[model samples]
Target: MDEVSPFAEVLGQAIYQFTLIKPLLPTYGHLLVSALFPIYIGAHASLSKPSSAAKSPKKSQEDGYESDTEEDESLGDTHKMESLAPSDALMFPLTAGLTLGGLYLVIKYMGADLLNKILGYYFSQMGMLFAIAFLKDCFAVIRSFFFPRKYSGSGRIWKPKPAERVFQGARDDGSSSESLEVRHSPLPGILGAIPLPHTVRAALWTCREVAYWRARLRIHVHRLLHAECWLSVLDLLSVAVALPAIGYFTFVTKPWWLTNFLGFSFCYGTLQFMSPSTFITGSLILGSLFVYDIYFVYFTPLMVTVAKTLDVPIKLLFPRPAGPGEAPDTISLAMLGLGDIIIPGMMVGLALRFDLYLYYKRKGMHKAQAQGNGSDIVKPVYQSAMGGWGERFWTRSVTPSEPELEPPYHDARSFPKPYFTASIVGYVLGMLATLVVMQIFDHPQPALLYLVPGVLLSLWGTALVRKEVHEMWEFSDAEEEDEDSSVTDAETKEPVEAGKQVSLFSRIFSAPKEGSERPPKSDEANDESVDGKSDKKESPEKLELFTISLYHPRKRETSKLKAPTERGQSPEDDENWALVGTAERDAEPPAKRLRRSPRQH
Candidate 1:
């Protein structure tokens, strides 16, 4: 950084500017992102790829950094960092608090903006890190809710461990044919958004628990008061309204009120996915102008305001191992004011409530019409009222059906999924409500964050989906056993040429053309014929190559004559192969002791 043409002077000057702003960034939490990005990335990578070491192993140690604090770890060893451990999450925040005061001191000694850029780069990397996990969650949500596949072959094969038993029951008592598919957790998607210290994640989770109780309390009141709490319904509505508001803020409008909204979000950059409920609220806010356009627009001036208002002194509590002229860069922002997050969040909530209002009103209208015998207006009374086209607008139909639109599935987890479409509608409404709430709050601003809650709201409707399918299944199961039986028969009639494309990695190491999985000898016992002559049996070598996973290590069996007792010495521990009993041995010749198929000619 120091040696290039005018680079050293330019770099020094940038650091000088960064020093100016570093003091104030802490009030809004952008400083934390700067401080922890590297560690977050390292920790995330290490956990994601436990088998792989850090790129430059020595460099990581020299940096005195480990992705995970020993305390953050517990049961969820690989994918999750948890334990309901609240105190552990506080470690990063507490350390960050102390470091704020020293930030300007370093800035004075080193160049300001120079340090800022350096820190900025790493935090940007953290965003990328979180993004990867976010995308994975996105894909998983899609796979689980839509385009679901029943995976063929065994679920997984861990070396020297028993394979997962996806199919539990055997053929006799009618368990093997049960239709079930195991789905992996979608937790990582929510976590990717809130990359924090262990304690912070825990605290955030704790906060959510608290929020859920509050939401539940509201539900109780609604029920007791006969006001229709409809928790699930409201959540979906909020998301729908929030989405439209988000689109509005992001693309439609840029009112003067927008600046405050954007200013606050950038300042408090804890902008990632959280749980779906809160996320819908947050999504509405994000869809507001603050996130997209308003961000770059007011960023600099906001920093100046932050530089003036934040009282906390900045410092470098943990200094980096320095290069010749490296100085740690910190960030400052406009204000501690949360107008951005709060206003939009409220907007989403209001939208959800309003949608609930409209929904009940519509249902009431529906009941009134039914009482008056006006139910046949929408389309065919049976299809529109009883069954099909009128119910599922997501479905494709130019004309309408007279009967119920969708044929329900037997499985609870199986589709016509829970709240997905409803949530989208909820998200859009949440966005709208956010705008309205902002107007009510004496600030009619339009920023992009307004849409976040709406998106989150969109997911709410998904929760009830499980019940709907379960109902359909119950109906079918009670209706007729033969319907269920037919579905089962369709699944297991294996095709003559099954599984041509898939290949197991282990098979490559074996001799070419060897049978992939020769079934245990017992399953293929020779059949007796009414005639004396024997039937020509198919040889094992000609069996189609299908992969059977190897998880457990093959433990060599010992012979009775040469078995090793406990604490006994082993000469070589070579696998002991037992010679067949004399009666069986006499049935086959010594030169070629092969499986005989009852005298095949």
Candidate 2:
């Protein structure tokens, strides 16, 4: 005992700490899968536009970017330029390492009491972030209602109108000016097209018209009474109610489900607002996190300690029931971080959406074959209702307006079911594997280490088995080319040619402008600008082009992340679009999206 070395003492302490984990692992084992279920369900069902959709030119104006001064543009440009240089991929690792290193030094030199202060500050900051997330979720719901199907390039609040021929056919301005048309009616045109009995159709039409007029009346009355004032009042009232409720739940009552629900809402809404654009990008991000989680949980004490002491809803917890003869309400909880579920679940959702797209493409392929003009088919609107036999016959399906069908010859073999099947199975297996390791070692392990490998293995292994590795890796080439063609054709089109007004629903989901406040400048203007001789006076064609760019959806193009820029100045514009476009690639098949099962959400 007197001759015991320092190394032996440290080893003894490590063994002692590890020995204590045996009871803890068994206690939490029952909670592993159930705790993760909600996130799994929510993320899989989360249908969101690409994050870039938020930057849509119309959205920019809606979000108050229309009033942005020249100073703001200058600032944005500077920020954009700064972001253009390639940065370190390991930035997160470096920042985390430094912060933790500094904390360690402080704890070792100063004392545990000082460490408590730092942790308290950290948790406080985290709570504020959570609160902000809650607010964002609330606002997201509002935006979704106002801008339905924004992510899928459908349902914009504003539609562009071509110049109306006025008196003498001469407008005040020499160049034509476009006006925005607001869609006041909430009902679909497909409702009118429904193949119901005349009496039934009349009743439905009456109901819709009555509803629309009622809304119009309400809007008019609200405007007469200053709607903005009332809205501000409502906002204040909401804040007043929210603060007390938040405080009561967070501190006074401290209900687990309440906090957890809020946290889940935040995660769900945020993920829905900003989604992964591609399978590969999703995989890469998940892979990095897998490594991060393993290192933090296994190699260091930080993750566990922070998780336990933080006492926040960042992780979901499920309380397991007591065994026979034990206390009835003993709280043995199983816990999982939000990230573990969300990251993998996103891939599942994308695969599922891809399955729907492929299903339509398969149908469109048959239709294209029958029509006998697959390659040059500019617009193929397929209307086949899905549901109960009578209902299918009675109701008309709403067809997506853009993205013309691809030919059968170029159609790649798509096995969407396998991707989804493998991902879900791998997730469950990975969860079980994580528990098994914990049970064996009697220690905490990172769930993602198993989860990431499980998902990757399942996805890639299924691809390999189906001999679709290359196809899946290079999925949607035809779709991508079509989208590209649409964008190119759109840029080259005469504005007057774009005057045909699409229905409201079509305009919403149709590709309007990509990004930017102003339309793309013509090559002549571009040359002039380069030579310092750009004209202040815009040609009618340019005006017409701008109007077309603003209002018209690109022909045969699917919804993509990159459209056009507002001012066409941001350097990061293209790279950012590329990153987000990958997420939206799967959502663009020109067919009615299958109505999601209520149970899934």
Winning model by lDDT: 2
- Tens-place lDDT digits, model 1, residues 51-169: 11111111111011111111112111233211111222233223333443355455556646665555544433443334333333333334322211121123221110012211121
Q: Lowest-lDDT window of 10 residues in candidate 1? A: 382-391
Instruction: Quote the positional error of residue 166 for candidate 2 in Å.
Output: 45
Deviation (Å) of 407 in candidate 1: 26
| Lowest lDDT block of 10, candidate 2 | 77-86
- TM-scores of the models, in the order given: 0.21, 0.45
Error at 139, model 2, angstroms: 17
Full-model lDDT, candidate 2: 0.44
Candidate 2 lDDT score at position 548: 7
Report RMSD for candidate 2. Answer: 19.2
Residues 1-601, model 2: lDDT tens digits? 5888999999997787567555555545545544455445444334222111111122122111112122122211111000100112244345555675666666557755656655544543455544544453344334333322211112222221111111011121223323422322222233322456656645543543222121100111111221110122223434565566566655565455655655565455444433344556556656766777888888888777656544555677655555447887786566677767766766665555445444555555555676786653223332211111222232233333443343211111222355777778888899888877775676878898998898878888887897867756654211121354677656665353332323223434557566524554443454354434433453433221110001111112222334556756332322211111112223322211111111100
Provide the clashing-pair count of each candidate structure: 102, 18
